[model samples]
Target: MPSFTRRSLVALLAAGSLGLAACSGTPSATPATPAATASDGALKVGIAQIVNHPSLNDLRDGFKEGMAAAGYVEGSDVVYEERNAAGDQTTLTAIASSYATKDLVVAIATPTAQAMIQALPDTPIFFAGVTDPVGAQLVLSLEDPGGNVTGTSDFPPVADQLALIKEILPEAKTIGLLYSSAETNSHIHADLVKEAAPALGLSVQEATVSNSSEVAQAAESLADVDAFFIGTDNTFVSAIESVVQVAEARQIPLVVSDPDSVARGALAAYAVDYRAQGVQTGTMAAAMLTSGGKAGDIPVERAKDLELSVNPGAAQRMGVTLPQAVLDRAEHTIG
Candidate 1:
């Protein structure tokens, strides 16, 4: 009988050099056979991030877990190549370009995804934490996608934000919408907030910033507002400390569209867990790869659930008192 070793068997299967039912040893008579032409070794996966943070890390970890669930175990059937931009678009583009040759690229945020889409036109791409895939030009439409990009969106329930604003500040006749004009997600969310505010007997004041350097001024410009609404703008999130500084100094409460923003400094926020979006993206990727379905066939999806988070410490600092009704209903509270 031939001496069979695990490494030799794996090599044979990986190279399509040989096929074997099982390693001959003192064991069960019937052994598991290697399926002919089965997936070679690990599927190469690339992950690109605009920056590294707890929220983004969750998405990466979730993607890993989802891949595992899809029968792609790391080191065995999957290899993850991760890159971070440290909040720089130039860096993001460089990282995305570097991963263009990977089997699959999963971009964590809007900037990274857009960079990947522009850099790797043919590579299959999955994006999470994007607000508007169509607006970003990542896809032609949510229905057919019509491209190599598809993933999940973290667009907050815009109407819900307005509703929460009204509930929290009934006397707030005019609310301020602060965001970066360049961010597609921020623009979409701002529009939604505008459309919904009027119905809630409130008016919206648009305070647009072109970049992080202007966020503090934008926040200060909206200081007179009864409430300051922060959209999911990467530029703004990157400059959250500045915004929070102005808001704190002015005693102006902030309501953000991301939980992480609240954790960082915002008074309160409603958000969808981005990591869960990563899991969703991974599942979609697995389905597409396993069935040979095109990425375009899977339309971009929205968050399945939203979480409400309140920061009482921030609220107190800004003199914004959230009613018990709202507080009790929140998924999490910090103070």
Candidate 2:
């Protein structure tokens, strides 16, 4: 396993930023009030995101859009404050604590949600990007959170993802999983993949990393495996290109759980649309704000829109061929 140098990572990020800029468009915004106090009859909302990545960034943008669609326009109906922890636990704790004064707080990832749950035990908390709220212990149950928490879950259809992998590489017998051990969502997805892969005649091999800096090394450790399966792990997704560099070199097909990752060079993905998850979360939060209901009153929702994405060039680089049926079913395909 080769370790990535700081200079190499910087170059990779620079290239990624350029690619993102080329494809990025202005996000839609609505009129919302500046930050205000609850005493003024205005709604105060705080959003704490664990880190800045393409998928999480999209989730954040979609959240604001969803809020606007729900009639809570920013700069008019609601006072919104957004913060990012940059994947630091201490920063997340500070950000969570700062939201204590807010009327409602929306946490974007598992870690941030956990921080909010700890810092604002009684405050209304809406969460997104969480794969398993119950497993993370953020809520008692998905149906009735029974606490100051309820939101959308980004739980990927693990079986569908694995089936896609098998469909692309029917001769594959071992599937490699690259994920972050620190993320509860990663563990949940990894467990599901492990359980589901066996039925597809695939054995699971895992390589865990604690942060983006370790992703290259972890991915390299799994070089001998037949294919790589990346779940919706924030750490891995944040540094996907590094994994792509190795996968392309080794000709290992990379299948991810987020469609956004496919555009980043992964071979394919069959999973939820994270931005839609944010919209669902925001809609639930809007209902609470409108009815003045408690957070616990809303049931935790799952992302309803699932789509398949394939990258033909990526598949070719990884030495895998996508069948016509799979291509026909894909909502999006990148050449």
Tens-digit lDDT string for candidate 2 (11-117): 43343111000101112222223455434666888887777677787778788888899998676688788887777776677777877888899888887788899
In order, the Cα lDDT scores of the candidates are 0.74, 0.80
User: What TM-score goes with each of the models?
Assistant: 0.83, 0.88
Residue 152 CA displacement from its true place in model 1, Å: 0.9
The candidate that achieves the highest TM-score relative to the unseen native structure:
2
What TM-score should be assigned to candidate 1?
Answer: 0.83
Candidate 2 stretches with Cα past 4 Å from truth are: 1-40
Candidate 2's TM-score reads 0.88
